[model samples]
Target: MTESNDGIDRRSAAPMYDQLRRLIVEHIENDRLQPGDPLPGEHRLCDQYGVSRTVVRQALGQLEHEGLIERVKGKGTFVARPRTAESLVHTLVGLYEEVERRGGHVHSDILRHERITADAEVARALELDEGAPVVVLERLRHVDGDAWSLSTTWMPEDVGTHSFDVDLREASLYRLLAEQGIVATHGVRSAEATVATHEQAQLLGLTAGAALLRLRSVSRDESGRPIEFFVAYHRGDRSRFEFQLDADSSRGELIRIP
Candidate 1:
């Protein structure tokens, strides 16, 4: 390995492992290291940073946990390729936004996009009359060329009909809605474990019956009117969810997405 003159500063108050983690992330963000590029081994990192092996390992472990790097069993660690964006369930954000925030490429394959009569469940969720017009959009979202999510969204006719004219391959549904003066301000979401169906498995490149994380949410406008009912299927191994709660606030208990 080439000598690294940018060694950690022992005088800094920050922990060495944290400093190392920052350095690695900086390298990634700066494009000094490309995706799939192998990272220097533990020994090399130790020597380059003038730190102990334990410190090097700890830093690597943290990076792995953060999805910034991946370790191959026999091969060395490499800059991690972007998988599914780690969805924070409590946040009323869309998948496209999450992927873009992480500097990952996102594209969608529109499986179904058309106006349809609202089914009983969809009508109930949107507080619309049964058999009323509703727009349905089904897409398979990809992250860095890998299938990440299979999403199905239903919206009231007035809101969803606009989607038919929009180019969903490149446009975000939420963004399109916002353009039409429909903004989602709040949402109620739930997540559960599920088994993939044959269709889902084929689309996501997994075997049927594979474990998946299924998320359902109902988003509302500023007037508290439900605007959309959304469902997403995420690969259990590729995505993780995190939430931050205030101890003094309501529902203070911590919950993690398994």
Candidate 2:
């Protein structure tokens, strides 16, 4: 393997292991490493990157957690084969953006997009008075031509209806919101496993009573004002979610969802 001193930058604000992990991903992306190909052993990586074994382990652990690489018993880590399912970290980007970033062909079929009076949940989520105007967006997310998820988003009508005029099937909602000077800086996310309803299954191309993963989120701006409320139902057979927790953060507790 070719070694370059440019791989790690001591002056960078990013952690050393993160940089190393990116370097490895770059190698895979650049065709230097093919799927199922063995990655350099920990000692070799340590020597090549001029980092300690702990750093190497951290990097490897992250790569494995992301499904980019895998470790077999008594065998070194290797590049993982391409996956048919979709996954994303708990980030602010929309589902379409995430799927496209992972090299999947993604598009949305807009089911409902109109101004409506806020229901109790929508009003509470957006901190608006009951029956206030809100823009409701219902969509079926297609990944690789499969209807993978059903999502509904609600935003204050004044903020969403007046500004959102683009073709949502061809645009990202978050991007459109940003162009209008509204950006979500943080969000609260929670997920649960539930069986698909008959209507949901019909929309998602799954059978009724099939397992589903439901994600609910409330996004807010820097001023702590709620910007959007989103709920998504994902096909359990075709989707997953991954989260990275800081080992140093006291609030970083890992919750396993069945």
Please tell me which predicted candidate would have the highest TM-score against the true structure.
1
For model 2, the superposed segments whose C-alpha errors exceed 4 Å read 1-89, 162-164, 250-258
lDDT of 2 by residue, 1-258 (tens): 578556799999999999999998988878777767988889889888899999998998888757688665457878975545444436787787787787877788999998899988899889999999999999998887777889999999867874456888867888888878899999777778898898997888555776688888889999999989989998765666776668676475465422
> In candidate 1, residue 41 scores what lDDT?
86
Give the alpha carbon lDDT tens digit for every residue of 129-222 in model 1: 9999888999999877878889999998888878877778876788888989999998788888898898998898766775688998899999
Best by lDDT: 1
TM-score of 2: 0.64
TM-scores of all candidate predictions against the true structure:
0.66, 0.64
Model 1's number of clashes is: 0
lDDT against the true structure, per candidate, is: 0.82, 0.81
